[model samples]
Target chain A: MSLSLNQWTTRRWSVAEAVDGCVRHGLQAVGLWRQNVAEQGLAESVKLVREAGLRVSSLCRGGFLTTGSAESLDDNRRAVDEAAELEAACLVLVVGGLPGVTPGEPLGSFSRDLGGARERVAESLAVLAPYAGERGVKLAIEPLHPMYCADRAVVSTLGQALDIAERLPAEQVGVVVDTFHVWWDPQVFEQIARAGERVFSYQVCDYLHPLPADVLLGRGMMGDGVIDFAPITRAVLAAGYAGDVEVEIFNADVWAADPDEVVATMKERYASVCGF
Target chain B: MSLSLNQWTTRRWSVAEAVDGCVRHGLQAVGLWRQNVAEQGLAESVKLVREAGLRVSSLCRGGFLTTGSAESLDDNRRAVDEAAELEAACLVLVVGGLPGVTPGEPLGSFSRDLGGARERVAESLAVLAPYAGERGVKLAIEPLHPMYCADRAVVSTLGQALDIAERLPAEQVGVVVDTFHVWWDPQVFEQIARAGERVFSYQVCDYLHPLPADVLLGRGMMGDGVIDFAPITRAVLAAGYAGDVEVEIFNADVWAADPDEVVATMKERYASVCGF
Candidate 1:
C-alpha cells in the first residue's frame, strides 16, 4: 500500500494500463511521465488515475533547465502545469547536463563549462519555483549519478541538490533521494538526514554492475543489483517523509517484460527490500 | 618537460618503448604500470628508465585493499617494493571496490556493505603505510570516478580519499588528482587546496561523452572531451603540487593508434590546455 509504480519501470504500459496494473497489485499510488500523459491526453490521464483511486506521487521530470532558454522555460512551466493538473506531490527535475554537447558529435565540441551549466540550473529553478508554489506544487531536484554529469544532469549528488534547494524556499523546491543515484556517495546517509523535510520524494532502483553498453538503461530491480534499500528507506522515513516509495527502473530487459509480472515483482521487492 | 606519459596511454608499448617514447618527446618522466614492469623485468625496467634519464613519475597501482586478503596484501607489498626499486614518486592505489562481488555473478548476492569495504581499505592502508614509508615509497590513493565506485574503487571522492589519507602519515599516504576521475566533483577545487602537500601525483585525461561501450576505455585525450583543463591545472599548481603532470588515458581507440602520434598529440595538448 505504501509502494508506488513509476511508469517507467513498466515503460511500455499506457497510462490506463499502468493504473490498472497498480489497481490489480493493490498499489495506492502511481508516478506519471509527461510523454505518457500527453499521449493519453492530459485530462483523460488525470481522470484515469483519479477514477482508479490512485494518488499521483510524482511526475517524471520537468527540469532540462540548463539552457535557460525561453523555449526550455516554457516547456518546464507546461510540465509544472501538468503536475498541478494531476495534483502530483512534486515535479521531479532531471536538470539538464552541459549545454551544446550532443551525442555522436566530436566529444566536447562545444562548451565544457560544468560550473556554468550548474549555475544555469540554479537560475532556472529560481524562475520556476515561485510559479510552482503559486500552483500549490513542489519542484523536486534529482541529482543524477556522477556518471551522467557530462551529458545528463549536472547535479550529481544529494548534497549538491540540497545546496541548490536550500538557496530557494524549502516549501517550493526540494530534492528526490533516488537510491540508484545516491547510494554510492559516502556522505549519502548524512545528506539524507540533512535533507529532512526537503525530501519531496523517495525513488528506488538498483545499480547494476558490468553496466550495459547504454548505461542509461542499466538500472536493475531492487534485489537484482548492488543497492541495499533498507538503510536509505529508513533514512528517508526518519527524515519524516511518509510518502509513497516509487519503484523507478530503466532497464531495457525490464521494459520488455510483461507489465503485470513487473508490477507483481515490484510489489514483492518493495515489501521485502524497502523495510516498510 | 613537466608533462609525463602514463604507460597505459600507449598500453601496447613495452616498458623500454614507453621510456624511449618519453625520451623522444623530450618528456622528463613516465608513469609505469606493474604488469608492464613485470614484463620487462623489474631490474631492467629500473635500468631502462634510469638510463634514459626519465623520472618514474608514479607506479600505476598497488592497492586492492578492500578484500583485505593476505594474498592481496602480499601482492601490494611486492608492488611497493617495485616502486621503491623504480624510485617512482608514489605507488598509485586503485583501491578495490565492494567485496565478494565478482563480475558476471548475481548483483547484490555479495555484501553491499560499502562502509565495511571502506573500513577494510583504511585498515589495509594502516598496515601498508608504515611498510611503504620505511621503503621511501609513498602510497597514492586514487579516488576513481563514481561510475567505477561499484567495482573499481571504494574511494570515490578526493575528499573521501583525503579523509582516509589524513589518518595515516602524510609522507607515506597521499592522493592522486586524476582529472578523469575527480573533475565531476563539486568540491574539487576546495579539496585540491586542502590536499596541499598530500597531493602525490597529478594525472590528466578528459571525460569523453557518449561513453564507449566499455566505460573503462572511455577516457579521451585533453581538449577532446568535456573538461575545462586550465582551471583544474591552475588549481593543482596553486595547491603546491609541482610533480610531473602525467597524461594517463585508457581509450581503446587511443590504444590502437600510432604511439608516436599519440605522444605528439599529448605534448601539444599538454602545452596548450595545461597552461604550463
Candidate 2:
C-alpha cells in the first residue's frame, strides 16, 4: 500500500544502507537485487531491512536465456531460490537475448537470430516458472522496453507479455508492469487490462535519454522522462494490483547526487507526478 | 519486378553514382532520399535516373512529425513535393516522434497521446496525400522499428499503420513493409497477412545489433540478420504485392565501404537469401 525503493534507484548505497535509507524515506517496502544481497550478505541484509522495519517488495536478479546457456538456466534457478530465501513477492526476470556472450565486435555479417533467442527465453522460463512458483514466489515477467529486445529482453510489448502470460496459469505466472519499458507500446492500456489482476508488481522509471545499449545503468528517475505515470498507475490499479509502488531506476546522474537528497527528491516527485 | 537498391544501400555513392552502381549491378530500381535528391538537384537527378533507365521505386522519406516543428512540417511537405516531382512510386513516410530535435532523448514524459501525433501525421498526410496521389504517387507508411516510436514514428506496428490506412480509401494509403522494423514482432506474420494487397512496397534489412540508439545507420544487410525473409516474402507475395524488392540498409560501416562492392554483394545476398 506504500512505496518501495528498488535499491537500484540508489545504486551507490549498499543494500543495507539502501534499505535503511528506504526506511528513513518512509518507503514501506524495498526490492532487493541478488548482487546487493550477496554484497551485503543475505542474512545481514535481511536483518538490516527487518531492523529498519521495511518490506522486500520483490527481488530481481534472475532469468535471461541469452543464447541458450544451460548454465544460465541453473544460475537463474538459483536466483529463484535466493528470491524465495529473501521472502520476496516475485522474482523479476529480464529475459536474455541471443546465445553466447561474445557475439563479438562488428556484428559484421552477424545473424540476429532473435527468434532463436526468444525460444530460449520461453524455454528457460518454462523450466524455471514451476520452481519459483513452488517456492511461493511468483515469476514477474517484466516486459522490457522494445529497445532492449536485441540484447536485454526479447519481451518488448506488454501485449506480447500478456500473450506469454495467458500461456501460463494466472496463479503460476504474472507480469510486472514497468513504465520505462512499456510506456511506448500503443496497446499498453489494453494489454494492462489483459494483464489484469495478474499484475504482480509495478515499476516506474522514465526514459531520460534515448535507450542506451547499457540499458541497465542508464535508467531515468520518474518525472525526469516522458512517461505519463498517472495513466500507467490507473491501469495498474484498474488491473487490481494494490502492491507497493516500487521506484526502480538506474540513472548514473541520479546516483551521483547525494543519496539522501535523491530519496527526498524521488519521494516528492513520485507524489507530484504519480501521486503515491 | 526486380530488386531496387535503396540508395542507402550504397550510401557512399553520389546520386549519379548510386544510379550507376545499381544499374551496373543489374538492379532495375532504387529508392532515393529527398535530401540527397535536393543535393543532386531534382531535375538533374530525375534526368540521370531516366538516362540510367532505372525505376524510381520510392522516395526515401516524406515525414518527420517528431519535431512538430513548422519548419519540419514545411520540410516534409516539400519532401512530398519532391517525391512527386521525381515521379517516384511512393513517398515513404517515416512519421516523426515528439516535438524535439533529440530523437533518442525520449521526452521525460511518456506521450501516450499517440492519437494526437497520429492526427497530426494524418493531418499532414491529408494535405500531402492528395498532392501525392494526384501526381500518381502513393504514400507508403513505412512503420519504423518500434524503437523509433518516441523519436521517429509513433506508428510502430504494421497493424497500427493499417488502421491508419483504413482511414483513407485503400488505394490512397498503403504500407512500405521493411523487414528490419517488424521482423521481431510476434504479430508480424499475422499483420502481414492483414496488410494484404495494399502493400505498396517491401524492403529487407537485418538487425545485427540490439535495437538501440544510433539506429538509422545500424541496420543489417538482408539475410545477414535473423529475419525469416522466406516466410515474410511468401506472405507479401500471397498478399498480392507484386513490386520491386528494395534492399534498404543504413549501416554506416557498410556505407563507408565501396559503394560498388556494397551493391554487388547486396544483389548476390538478396538473390541467395530471399531469392527473386
Candidate 3:
C-alpha cells in the first residue's frame, strides 16, 4: 500500500520539488506530470527522481485522440517515449472531448458527435498500443468524470474504458481506476472486478459536493468528502492492481497549501481511510 | 411531435403566466412544478391550465426517497395527490442524493453510503408506487446527471433508473429520459430502447459546457450546446414514447430573458433542432 503523491495535488511544486517532497515525507513513489517534467527537462527529471529513490508510479497524460489530429497522435508517441525514458508504470490518458468545442467558446459552435469522438479514441489506441509495448510502457486510459465529457475526456466510465482496452494488447493497453471519476457509477464495482489485471494504475481522490466554479478542480483530499474509499480501494486490490495508489487532488485550496503539509495529509489519510 | 414547456424554463413566470405563454405559443402542454402549484393554490392552478386548454405533461417532481424519513414519504404522498388532481401524465421523481449532506456544508462532514441511499429509494418506491397507482398517477424516475449524484439525484443513468422501475408495476412506474442528464452516457441509446413502454416522459435540453458556477443551471436552449437531439429524440420515439416532448432549460441567461422570448425560442428549437 505504498502512497504516490501526484504532482498536480501540489500543483505549484516543480518536478525537483515534488521529488524532494516525496523523499522528505518518506513516500516511495511520485506521479509525474508532462508540464512539470518539461520545465525541468525530461533527462534532468529522470535523474532527480532516480537519485531521490522515488518510483515513477505514472505519467500524467498522453491522449486527446478525439480530434483525429496528426499532431495529437505525434504528441502521444512522444509521451510514450517520455514514459519509457522515465520507466514509469503507465502513461495515463485523458482522451479529448468533442472535436470543435474549446472552453469558453459560444456553446452553439461545437460538434454534437460524441459517438464519433469515442470512435477516434479506439482507433488512436490501435496505433499507440503496439508502439508503447515496443518501448515497454502501458497506455492507461483514464475514464474521466462525465462532467468532463464535453471539455476533457470522452471516456467517462471504467466499463467504457475497459471495453476499448480489451480489444488491444493486454500488456500494452489498460485502464486507470480513479475513484473521484468512477465512484458515482452504478456499475463501478462490477467494472473494477472485470478490469482485473488490466488495472494499470489506481488513483485516489474524493468527489466533493457544491463543486467549485471550475468543476475540474473539485477533487478533495480523502476523508474531506463524501466518498467511501475503503470499499473502492479493496475492490482495486481485489482486481490485482499491485501498484502504487496515487493521490491526485485538483483543488484550488490544496494547490495553495504548503506542499509538505499536503503530502503529509495524503499519507495519513491513505493509511487510515483507504483500505489498503 | 407536440411540444411542452416545463415551468422552470421561465423561472420568473407565475402559473397563470406560464399557462398563458403556452397557449399563446400554440403549445398544447405544460409541465407544472409543485412550488408554482402551491403558489397559485393547487385547485386554482389546475383550473387555470385546464381552462387554457393546456395538458399537464407531467408534474415537475415527487421523490426524495433516500432520506427514508416519514416526512419525506408524507410529502411524496401529497405530491402524488397533487399530480392526480391535476391529471398529470406522470409525477417525475428526482430521488434524493446522499442523506445528511446539506449544500455548502464542510466537505468532510457527509455520509459515504451511496448504496444505502439508493436502497432507500427502492424501498420508498415500493411504498409510493402503490399509492400513486391507486390514484392513477405514474411514478416517473428521472436519472439526473452523474455530476449531481452527490447533492441532487443518486439515480444517474437510464439503466439504473430502469433497474428500480422494473421492480414495481410496469403501468405504475416508469422513467424520464432527460437529455441534459443522460446525453453523456455511452449506453444511452441502448438504455433508451430498453426503457420502451416504460418511458414516462421525454425531457429535452442541451448540456452546456464551461458549466456555470452552479452546474444545476448549466442547461442551454436546444442547438445552443453540443447535444444532438435528433438521435435521442428518435430513440425515445422508437421506444414507443408518444408523449409531449418537454423543453426544460435551467439556464440563468434564459431565465433572465423575457419569458415570452424564451417561449418563442423554445418553440423554434423544438421544431427545427429537436427532431420531434
Candidate 4:
C-alpha cells in the first residue's frame, strides 16, 4: 500500500500487533507514537518493526515547547533519541500552544500570550535542532489546524512552519504537511511548494465539521470527509516528497471498529481517494 | 459605551428588549441580525432602534454564495436591502463554504470543492457589490476561523477577505475583522493594517479552547478567554476602523443570563479588556 498506518489511527493496537498487521496488509511503513514505543520497550519495539520488514515512517510527537524550559527541551531531546534509535524518517513535533496551563484547563484560566508561546517554540527549536542533527533524526514540525492553536500546537499553518524550518538546515529541520490540519488554508498549495524538499512527512486524514463531542477526536477517514486527497497528494509529490503517506485519524467511531477491519477500510479508502 | 452589543450575545432578548437593554446600559450602537429584524417588522425594528438612539452598526449576514445559485445571490441582495432600509453601517456576510450541502448537514456528507466554493463567492460578490453599492450598504465579508471553513466561510484570513474586497470599489465591499475568528492568525496585525479604510466593522470576543459541545456557541466574552484584546483593539483602531466595536459572543451560559446583566457585563469587559 502507498499508505502507512499511523498508530493513533488504531490506538488499541499494540506496537508488535500493528507492525504484524502492516506486514500482513502489505503496508511497508508504520508511524509509531512515543507512548506505544514505551509500552513495548523502545528497543524491543524498534527490533520488532525492523524484523517485520517495515520502515518506521515517523515518530508521532516530541514537542510541547510552549513552556520553553529546560525540562521541556530535555524531553524533546529524548524524543529525538527515540526516533533515531527506531531509525524513523523524522520526529514529528506538535509544537504546543500557550504556557502556564494544563491540558483540559477551565476556559476562564486560559492564558492570553499566544505570541510568547510561539516565540518560545522557535527558541526551543533552536536548542533542539543541533541535538536532533547530531542524533541523525530530523525534527518535523507539524502545523496543526487553527482550532488547536489555544490548547495544542501554536503553529497553525504550513507557511508558519516553513518559516521556522527555514531558519535551520533543511535536512535537520523539516515540516509535516498534514491534510486534516491544513486543507482549509488558501495558500496551502503555494506553501507546500515552498516547503519543497524540506517536507519531512506527508500525513493524510479528512476534516469533518460539526465536530464530534470532543473536537480533537473529530478527524474523519479519507474519502469520508470533505478533503480532496488527489490535489494535496499531487502537491506533496510535486514538492519531491517521496515519504510514506501516513493516515493518522483520531476518531471515536474509527477506534471502536475491529483493528483489522479498520486497516482494510483505510487501505481501500486511500487507494480510491488518493489514487495510489 | 463605544461597544455595540451584537444580537447573538444576548440571543434570548427580543429586538425591543435588546435595544432597551443597550439604552439602559448607555450603549450607543447595536449589531443586528436578520432573524431578529425579521422577528419584528423590518421598518419597526429600524424605528425602534432609532427611537432608542441606537445606531445599527452592521447587519448580521448576507452571503452563503458557496453554492453559487441564483437563489443565494438574490437572498444576499435582499439582505443588502434590509441593511439599507435599517440604515446599518454595513451588512456582514458569512460567505458559506463548499457546495451542495445545507447548514447542519451530517459531517460525513460535506462537499470537498473548497476552491470552487471560494471562486463562487468572488463571482457572487461581483454580482452583489454593485447592488449593495446602489443601496448605500457596504457588504462586509467576515472571514470566519479556519475551523469553520468546511461549513461556514472559506475566506479564512483577513488577507483572503481583502483579496475579495479589493476586486471592487472599497466603499461597496469591505471586510469585518472579528477577533474570535482571527486571534490565532500569525499575520493578523499586518492584514489589519492592510485593511485600513476597508475595515467595515470591528467585532470583539475571546477564543476559549476545550470548546463547548456546540462549537458555534463557544465564543467567550472579551476578558474571559485567552485573547489579549488590547493589541488587537489597538491594531483595529490604528487601521482607521472608526466603526462601532461590536461584542458578539455566542456562549450558552452568556445567553441564559439576564439580558440587562449580560449588557452590563459586556460593558464592563469591553472597558477593562478592550480599553474602550
Candidate 5:
C-alpha cells in the first residue's frame, strides 16, 4: 500500500492540480472530493487523473440521509454515479446528521432525535446500497468523530457503521477507518478487527483540540496531532485491508499552504507515522 | 427525585453562596466541587450546606488516574474522604486520560497508550474502592465525552465505565449517567438498563456545538441544547436511580450570571425537560 493524498488536505487545490501534486510526490493515488471534480467538470477530472496514471482511491462523500429530503437522496445517487465514473475504490458516505440542523444552527433548531436520525440512515442505506452495487460502486460509511454527531454525521462509531453495513452485502456496503474520527475510541481496534474485509478505505489525519472556531477544519496533518498512526495502520493491515492510505486533513493552515508544499508535508508526515 | 445544582455551573459562586442559591431556588441538593469545598475549608463548606438544609448530591470530581502518579491516588482518597465528610451521595470520578499528556501538549508528548492509562485507572480504582466504601462513599465513574478522551478521560463510554464498575461491589463502585457525556452512544439506553441499581448519580446538562475555546465550559443549560432529557432521565429512573438530577452546566455565560439567576435557570431548565 502507498499514500493517497486526499484532496481536502489541500482544500485550495483543483482536481487537476491535486493529481499533478500526487504525481510530483510519487503518490500512487489521490482521493477526489465531489466538489473539486464538479469544478473541473467530472469527465475532464476523470480523464486528467487516468491520463496521469493516478488511481482514484475513493470519492470524498455521498450521504446526508437524516434530512428525509429528496434532494439528499438525489445528490447521493449523483455521487454514486461520479464514483463509478471515476472508477474510485469506493464512495465515502458521511451519512448525515440530525435532520433539522445546519452547522452552527441555534440550539432551538436541534431536534435531539438522535435515534430517529440514525434510523433514517439505515433506511437510506437500504435504498442506496443496491444502486451503488449495481454500478459496481461500494458505499463506504465513514463514522465521523462523536463531536460531529449532532450536525455532521449520526454514525459516530465504526461498530455502528458496521451494524448498518452488515445488513447489506460486504462488497456493497463497508466502513472507512479514518484515524482522526476514531482514535479516541477505547474499542477502536476491536471494532477495526470486527470490520474485517468490510473495511473499504483507510483515511489518515490527526486530531488537535482547543479546536479552531470551525471545528470541522480541526483535523491536523499526520504526525502533527496525538494519534499514534503506526498502531492504527497496523490494525487495519492486520484486518486484511490492503488499500491506499488517504491523508484527509481539513485544517485551515494546511489548506492555506501551497498545494505542492501541502503534498510534501503530507508525504513526509505519512511516511514518518504510517510506515506505508 | 429532585434537582441538584452542581457548583461548577455557577463557578464563581462560593460554596456558601451556592448553597444559599440552591435554597433560594427551592432546591434540596447541591453538587459540591472539591476546589469550592477546599476554598471554604472543607468542614466549613460541609456546615454551610447542612445549615441551609441542602443535601450534598455528589462531589464534583476525584479521578486523574491516567497520570499513573501516587499523587493522583492520594488526591482521590482525599476526595472520597471529603464526600464522606459531607455525606454526599457519591464522589464523581472523571477518570483521567492518556499518560504523560498535558492539555495543548505537543502531539509528540501524547503516549497514545490508552490501554495502559485505562489499566492505571482500574488499578487506582482497586486501591480507592475499599477506602471509599469504608468511608461510606460511592465512587461514581463519570465517563466523559469521547472528545475529551485524549487529554481528559480514557473511560469514554458508559459501557466501558460499567465494565470497570462491575469488577467491584455495586455499593462501592457505581456509574454516573450524564446526558451530555453518553447521549451520542447508540447503546446508551441498553447500558443504562445494565447499570440498574449501580447508577449512583444521574447528571443532566445539554450539549451544544460551536464549542468555545475551552471545550470544558461548553455544556449548555438543559432545554438550551440538543439533548432529549426526558428519555435519559426516564432511563435512569427506570434503572432505580432515585437520586438528585444534578444540573451541571459549565458555560462561561452561565458562570458569568448572578448565582441566584443561574440557579433559577437551572431549576427551570431541569423542570422543563428532566421530568423530575
Candidate 6:
C-alpha cells in the first residue's frame, strides 16, 4: 500500500516546504491545493513537485457551488487547468454551501434550499466536466460531513454524490470516499460498493470528541476516533478501487506539532492501523 | 390549524401544571416523555392530562434497544404498558446505541460496532413489538441526527429507519420525521413520500449553535436555524399525515428562560413558519 500526503497534513508549511516535506518523508504521492498553486505559480509548483519526485495524487479542490459568481466559476476552471498541468490523478471538489457569511451564526438563514444548492452544484460540475475530461484529470466529488451542510458542501452522503455522478455524462466525474465524512452513514459500505469504479480516492480520517463549531480544523488522526478504517478500506478496495489510501487529517493539535514528527507518526500510524 | 404543547415544553413543570399552562396558552395537545410520567406516576399524569381536556399526541419514548438485560427488556415493555395506559397516539423510539462501556476510561466506548448496536436495537424491537401491538400504541422510530451515532440512537437517517420498518412483519413500526435531524437530507421529500402512513409523528425544529457537550439540553428554536420549515410541513401534510406536528425543542437557552414565554414564542413561530 502506498501513501499519499495531502498538502493539508502540513497546512502550516509553504508550498515549497510542503513538497520538500512530502519527499523527505518518502511519500511518493502528494495532493496539492489551489492556494499553494497560486502562491508558487502553477509551473513552478509543478516543477517543485516533480523535483521532489512525487506524483500528484489529486488537486485539493475546485467547486464551491453555493457562492457562485463569474469570478468563482473562472477560478474553478483555472483550478482544473492547473491540475491538468500538474498531471494530477483527480481534482477534488469541496462543493460550496449557502450564499454568504460562512455560516458563523447557527441561527442565520444559511440556505435551506438543498435542491437549489444541489442544482447550482450540478450546473457548475457540468461546466467543469468537459474541461476535466479534455485534460485527463478526473473530478472526484468529495462529499463533506453533514456538519458542513450550511457552509462547506451540501453533498453530505455518498449516495447523494453518486446520484450527482450518475447524472453527469463525464466519465471522469467520480466520488471521493472520505471516511471522516461518510463513516457515520449506515449506507456507507453499500454506497461504497455502489460507487464501484467511480471511487476515485479514499481519504482516511477520524473525528475528535467535544466537537467544535469550526469543524474545518477539528478532524482526528486515524485511530483517534470511532471509525473502523480497516473494514472501510476493505470495502473500498473490494469496490475495485486501486488508489492510494490518502491520509488527510485536519487536526489543529496534530498540525501544531512539528511537521516532520507529524509525517513520521502519520506514516507509522497509517500502516499500523490500516495494516499496510 | 392547531397548536400542540409537548409536555417537554414545560418539562420543569408538573404534568397538571404543564397541561394547565398549555391550556392557558390555548395549546391543544401535549407529547409527554417517560420521565414526566415517572415523576407524576402514570395514572396521575394521564388523569392530569385528560382532566385538562388536553390531547396526548405521543408518548415521548419507548425503544431503547441498547440494553440486553432481561430487566432492561422488562423495563421497556413497561414503557409500552405506560404508553397504552396514557392512550398515546405513538411511542417515539430513540433506538439505543452501545451496550456498555469498554472499561478503558470507565467511560463510553465510541466504537462498539454500530451495526451490532443496530442489531441489538432490532432485537429489542422484536421483543417489544408484540407487546406494543397488544397495547394499541404505534411505534414511531425516531432517527436521531448522525451526531448522536456514538452515544445516543444508532438510527441516524430516515432511509435506515424505513429499511427497518419495511423488514418488520407489521406496519405497527414506523418513523418520526423531525426537521431537526433530517432537514439537511438531499432525499427528504423522497423519504417522506416513502414513509407514507409509516411516519407516525413529525417534529418541527431548528438547530441552534453547536451545543456545548454540557448544553445538549438546548436545541435551536424553529426558524432560528437554517431550516426552511414551510415547504417541508407542506410535504409532510401532503403525504397524508394528519397527526400532531409535535414541537420538540431541546434547547437549554429556551429551557433556561420562562417556559411560558418559550411556549408562546414557539406557538407564534410554528404558526408563522409552518402555519400549523
Q: What is the C-alpha lDDT of each candidate?
A: 0.91, 0.77, 0.91, 0.89, 0.87, 0.79
Clashing pairs in 1: none
lDDT per residue, candidate 5, A1-276, as tens digits? 788989888888899988888888898999999989999999999899999999899998899899667788899999999999999999999987786777776644557788999998998889899999999999999999998888889999999999999999999999999998999887899999999999999999988754666778779987766677888899999999999989888888987788888888778877787773
Model 3 ranges off by over 4 Å: A104-109, B104-109
Q: Write the per-residue lDDT of candidate 4 for residues A82-155, one digit (tens) a residue.
A: 99999999999999877755546676445678888998899899999999999999999999999888888999
* Candidate 6 clashes between residue pairs 3 or more apart in a chain or in different chains: A64-A96, A65-A96, B218-B251, B218-B252, B219-B250, B219-B251
What interface-residue Cα RMSD does candidate 5 give after superposition?
2.0
Model number with the top DockQ: 4
Interface RMSDs of the predictions, in order, are 2.2, 3.7, 1.7, 1.6, 2.0, 4.2
Give the per-residue lDDT of model 6 (tens digit) for A35-129: 88888888899889888888888888888866557777897888888888998888899898766526444444455676788888887787778
True contacts kept of each: 0.70, 0.38, 0.70, 0.71, 0.49, 0.32
- In angstroms, give how far residue A239 of model 3 lies from its true place: 0.7
Query: Which scores greater on DockQ, model 4 or model 5?
Result: 4
* Total clashes for model 5: 0
lDDT of 1 at B178: 92
Q: Show the lowest summed lDDT stretch of 10 residues, model 3 chain B.
A: B101-110
**Can you rank all candidates by DockQ, best first?**
4, 3, 1, 5, 2, 6
DockQ of each: 0.65, 0.43, 0.68, 0.71, 0.60, 0.42
- lDDT string for model 1 (B1-276, tens) is 289999999989999999999999899999999999999999999999989999999998888899789999999999999999999999999998888766445465577888999999999999999999999999999999988887889999999999999999989999999999989899999999999999999999988888888888879999878888888988999999989999999998899999999999999988888784
**Window of ten residues with lowest summed lDDT in model 1 chain A:** A101-110
Q: In terms of TM-score, which candidate is stronger, 1 or 6?
A: 1
**Model 4 regions more than 4 Å off:** A107-110, B107-110
Model 6 CAPRI rating: acceptable
Of the pair 1 and 2, which is ahead by DockQ?
1
Query: Candidate 2: lDDT over CA atoms?
Result: 0.77
